[model samples]
Target: MSPKILVVLSSHDKLGDTGKQTGWYLPEFAHPYYKLEGKADMTIISPKGGAAPLDPSSVEMFKEDAEASKFLKEKEALWTNTDKLSNYLGKADQYDGIFYVGGHGPMFDLATDSDSQQLIKEFYEAGKVTSAVCHGPAAFVNVKLSDGSYLVKDQEITAFTNTEEDQVGLSSAMPFMLETKLQENGAKIVKADQPWGVKVVQSGKGGKLITGQNPASAAGIGEAILAAL
Candidate 1:
């Protein structure tokens, strides 16, 4: 069987109280989708189901990238047909792995959704390739493993760093810094020297959890996940 990969996206469109719009970052999803589409069967899911919103700035930023353009033009159905996270909470065994795509949106919903938390834990316990990129790791902030330990505890992982969050100017609006929360959860954070530089980490525990630092690391994360599979 071609491995089935579940791609979870954030459904929250508003970025905290900033009155700014945000959702799944286009390149974060587009880059990985292009990388894994032919090699795996991918399913899209979100908190509310239906069409997940797009981060407007990301759409404009990658407007000219050929792969992104192709994805925008050809994958409209995937955007409209997402399954609700609730629908798959106990079905993690059906998937070979889970990929969380990030934008500012994940910070609002995926970080706290109990269903998403449970699904992530299930995937982790199954010894599957569980992965996330950028703010996508927000989903990992509260996940507890079967042994009642925080999944990220002592794991070598990377996500949108505090410096990158400040550079983006969303720090004040966000509930808390992602890197800090991950650290509080006991993850040993790793980061790239420069913002937008590529950084991907395989969890200290036998490389089951794969993470990427930022949007620029999306394609690399996809490659790593495929290799893990």
Candidate 2:
């Protein structure tokens, strides 16, 4: 049987403020969804049960990209009816891996939610690949392993960087910076040329934990996860 993977999305709706443009970027989720959907039995879930928000800017960009445009119009059901994370936490062992999709929104909720932290721990301890991209790595900030250590500590990984955060003008708006926090916790951080550059890092003999720099790296990240599986 093909492996099953759980794709967790951010539930945050506002960006900086309620009226501003911020949420999950369309391409980030679409590219990976396309790559993994058929090859793996994939299930999309969110911190909240329904209606995952889209960053307005991403929606505009998608309108211009044919693939993304098609996804937006045809995958309406996925966006409108995401499974709640709470419902899946009890059944995490059913999946082969867990992937956290990125957006500024994850920084707002994924990092601190107790349920999210627990899910990460459960998946990691079960020997499943636990992967994330961009600010999605923020969710790892508080995930504790069976030994009581942060799951990411001393692991070589990459995420949306501090410099990129400033370039995007979100450095001041985020609850906390991802790169800084990851380093402070003992991760040996690796990065690519620019904030928007596509990059991915995998660590462990089985390549069990994976991370990507940003949305541009989502496809590569998905490939890595599939390979590991």
Give the per-residue lDDT of model 2 (tens digit) for 141-223. 87888898888888998999999889888788888899999998878899987668889999843779999998789889989
Among these predictions, the greatest lDDT belongs to 1
Clashes of 2: 0
Range of the 10 consecutive residues with the lowest summed lDDT in candidate 2: 14-23
Clashes of each: 0, 0
Global lDDT of model 2: 0.85
lDDT of 1 by residue, 15-105 (tens): 8887789899998999999889889999999999999998998889999888888988899898777999888887888888999998999
Residue 151 displacement (Å), model 1: 0.6
Report lDDT (CA) for all predictions: 0.91, 0.85
74 in model 1: Cα distance from truth in Å? 1.3
